[model samples]
Target: MYKDDGFDLVFSYTFPKCDLDGSYQAVQENSTHKICVDKEGSVLTAVDKIENKTLADAMDCNCLRANLIITSVEKPTCEVNGNYSPIQCRRGTCRCVDNNGNQVCKSSVCEVAEIDRDTLKC
Candidate 1:
């Protein structure tokens, strides 16, 4: 996604525009969406209502059009797995690390989380 002057030039993951309710294909000659993530990731609460479609056999096999809003990471206060852990984003993007430098999430950079008010953006 390219952001210039506050407007984000997202490949095909913006919202409303790229969101296609169920499944559809881009025209390519005119379609502005592209392949983003293929993993079974969850959309943030803020953008759960948005819809998207997928175009098969495009540039990449994992390309899908969806409006993905990044959310902030929540802190877990209870013991999960072994110690008190921070809740990680189920989208498989960001994970919560312990306060003591423990990698709580199984993903890579996707585990790094940031808190923006009540939302978690990874």
Candidate 2:
């Protein structure tokens, strides 16, 4: 099953898209949605509701189109308005960010372990 999670298409695994531990993920054709494909890479789980009349050989959907598909990397936080959060965190540091997650506000790199998070205010 899949749903348009605003940002991307999310899925529940069974036997085709994935097995016990994982699911099949691929780059979107136009690189828009962030969803998963079949383990055989034949089927794609759409972000929005789709009608599956019968078992299809191949069909594509664009609900999870995201720029980044590398699941390992951490993404910058964003507001509900789709702008970057004022504060963003890296492995060792946190800093002020602009709408696009660009570092901003002169210098505001606070250590991740810093107690006073106010230092991260932009």
Candidate 3:
């Protein structure tokens, strides 16, 4: 409704903002990547493999831009630069993840005894 109310309303059906540079869109459930899209949410960039000369970077639903581990994006605590936090806690277990969100350092999942500890060691 930001447009003018005129006879052009019946002639054009597209939004200008959604047509240029595309619009930021949400990915499917359980998916780690968000995408830029058209008005109807069709992928507009070549980021599937991230090998093209076009756009390559993507932000996960968890606000993570570097790590894209399967089943790990959900309920994640991310760093300010979109890297996965070094330590994460969930389901009474805590673990360590690398910059790419992969479990690393040969560390085993640690069981948390106190629920009030914000910082966890793995």
Candidate 4:
């Protein structure tokens, strides 16, 4: 159906079945044209329908962004004042290190700490 409308391609991906109610009803009957909804039931801006590229592009971009977010966030063990806990580095700015064979979150700048230690004077 999409190909006849000049769409480059349509995805056959199936989203985990969500309860259909309220605003979620705005989602179309077609799975390929599914809307990106947040946990709060609001549509995500990155996947919202737009001109030119429109539905397929928005859905593809949303899928890519979702995959990137899922893969980029790493759960590293963090230690604060000798107490250890798992922490997710979703922002990509935080750094965790294994100190004494135990992973610990650095109290200072993560990026600077990632630099090779031998090159630094201190």
**Among all candidates shown, the one with the greatest lDDT:** 3
TM-score of 1: 0.16
Regions more than 4 Å wrong, model 2: 1-71, 105-114
Task: Tell me the deviation in Å of residue 113 in model 3.
Answer: 5.1
Off by over 4 Å in 1: 1-73, 80-82, 90-92, 99-122
Candidate 2 local lDDT, 1-122, one digit each (tens): 23455556434433334445564544223223333444445534433213332212132222222313427567665432223456766675677655445667554353333355566546
TM-score of each: 0.16, 0.36, 0.33, 0.21
Per-residue alpha-carbon lDDT of model 3 for 45-82, expressed as tens digits?
22332332122243332334223334663466764324
The CA lDDT at 95 in model 2 is: 73
Positional deviation of 101 in candidate 1, in angstroms? 6.4
Clashing pairs in 4: none
Best by TM-score: 2
lDDT per residue, candidate 1, 9-50, as tens digits?
657653422325543322121243333232332321111112
* TM-score (C-alpha, index-matched) for candidate 4: 0.21
Worst 10 residues of 4 by lDDT: 79-88
Mark the regions of model 3 whose C-alpha exceeds 4 Å error after superposition: 1-63, 66-73, 105-122
lDDT of 4 by residue, 1-89 (tens): 88998888746754443445533322232432344444344554323233323443423222322332354454333222111222223
* lDDT over C-alpha atoms for residue 55 of model 4: 43
